[model samples]
Every structure is written in C-alpha cells, then in structure tokens.
Target: MPVPGGSGREFNYPDVGAGRDDVSPAGYRSLEMVRELGTGDQIFDAASRRLFGWQMHRAAGIRLARSTPPPAPGVDVRLEWGVGPIRASAWCRVVDVVDEPDRRGFAYGTLAGHPESGEETFLVERDTDARVTARITAFSRPARWYTRLAGPLGRLVQRRITQRYLDGIADDQW
Candidate 1:
C-alpha cells in the first residue's frame, strides 16, 4: 500500500537482498564513527540492540508511526517526521540484518511510495585497532515528483538528517 500522502503507487522490492551493492552503482552518502565500546562483541551487541530498538531513527527526529514487537528481516515499519499538523510518514521494510565476526548491522529499503527509492545500511564494526565503529550508508533518489523538483534542497535535507543520525549515535547512551 502507498503511504498516507504518497503517490499511491504499489511499492516494489526488485532488488531484494541486494545489500551494500544496491547503493554501489550510484553516488551515495556514508558516515562512520569509531569509539570505545569495550570489546567487539559488546559493541556489536549494543549497536545492534540500539538499531533494532529504533533509538537511531528517534535520535534523528523520526518517531515510530507504526512498529512490530521485535525487529527482523522483512518486517514492516513506519516512521513519522515533524510534529503536530506538519507531519509526514515514510514506510519501509527491514531488508536484511548483519551479524558477522567483525561487523553487525541492518538495512532498510524504502517502499515505492516513500520519498526516496533505495536502501540504507546501519552497520557496526570492529577495526584492527580494536575500536568499535558505527556506519550509515544510503543510496537514494527522489521518488516523488515534488521531491525531484526540490532537487538540491532535498539533498541538503538528507545531509542534515545524516548528521542528525550521526549525532544520535554519538549521543546514544547505549
């Protein structure tokens, strides 16, 4: 189904399980941070928990419009922006989750009716220095006519949001 005020087009998952390559073909944004999180497993566990708990999105000023009890691949989720009458919603699906020895994270793909078309990955990794890192990579293009018209403004907004997510990660207590 289309998002509340979206284009009403049926969303497609043509690139299911595409993972990081899904954003490789195009110019995308990536942000990373490294810090002390005790050990590799501890960092992975904390970051993964924070991700599935929706704290990252919340820190970026997005709230849960709708959610499932526990986050997992293929789960449907909705996020809301702004407050009061100036609110908007975006629908998405958890495309995949990662749990490797040196890396852990999840990716979510935007539905057809959402403002963007692409996937975003949230990853936590342990570097050779034994420091834990959190990374966010996104590849997207405007999905709506209005967003396309906004062009540069849309990109600027995305950058700001990316920064917000980074700040959220840094400020996150978990």
Candidate 2:
C-alpha cells in the first residue's frame, strides 16, 4: 500500500515544503536551527554524507526503521523512538533534496501515521570562509491526540532532537 498523505499523493498538512521557505505556514509551529560543524571541505563532505545516510538520526538516538538510501525525492522513511512496545513511529516522504555547489541536504514531509503534520529540511552549507554549518528548518503541528496533549513538552523534545542532529554532525564519531 502507498503511504497516505505523501508527496504526489497527499500530505497530512498543507503548504508542503514550506520548511524551505522564509515564511512559516500559519497555524503551525516553526523551527530554525543553525550550528557550525567545523571548517574545510572534508568536514562539509562528511557532514553531508552523514545527513543523507541517516546517521544523524541514528546518532540522535532515533531508530531508522526504514529508509531509501541516499534520501532522494519521493523516498519513504520510517523512524522510531522509545523502546519495545512503547516505541513511537513516524512515517514521512522525502519532498525535496538540495544538491548545490555549497549546500547539501533534503526535506521530508509527514505522512498519515506521523505524530506531527509538516515538513523538515536539513542542509549542510560551506561558506567562502570554508566554515561548515548545519541548518535544520521545520514547520509542524500535532496530528495525534497524544502529541497535542504533550503541549510544551512536544516542542521541547523537538528542540532537543534538533540539537542532537547538529551535535551528531559536529561530533562525527561515526
């Protein structure tokens, strides 16, 4: 079966790929995070590789239940968190991929089963100074009752995970 609320199909939320734009859609929470990973082409390349390969999610303690390698547009990915029976799963589809001379990353939109309805973009950029920076942008709103109940806690968790994504690139242990 096809993923519900997916790209070319349907998204759980409207304004698909809004995360990449400067304006956040109305009635949704917006997030933008930037962190300097390091300097040089080597670090930029490594960070890009990790982000595309899903290593950032792994490093952030999220289980990559399934994903299409290299994260191309239309690719589906299932991510899980928590443990055992308590595990929560989020399904999404890659809506767009950034492959520019100075930037590399992709954006995925929430599917039907996702707790939140929206899109998130991850980009690794290298400036003229060769300083590598990681940027994560997202716009979302709770889709499930539990997430809605989470209220402020949900935002906190999202921020924490976003930080871990940057830390994953900065640390580069893997």
> Which candidate wins on lDDT?
2
TM-score of model 2 relative to the true fold?
Answer: 0.91
Q: What RMSD, rounded to one decimal, does every model reach?
A: 4.4, 2.7
Give one digit per residue, the lDDT tens place, for model 2 in 23-98.
Answer: 7799999999999887898999999989988989988988885535679877878788897779877788888999
Candidate with best TM-score:
2
Candidate 1 per-residue lDDT, tens place, 16-135, comes to 455566444334443333444455555567666776677778889998844353456766677789878899988887768877878777887787668877677777778777677677
Least accurate 10 contiguous residues by lDDT in model 2: 1-10
| Candidate 2 deviant stretches above 4 angstroms | 1-10
Candidate 1 stretches with Cα past 4 Å from truth are 1-13, 26-44, 65-67
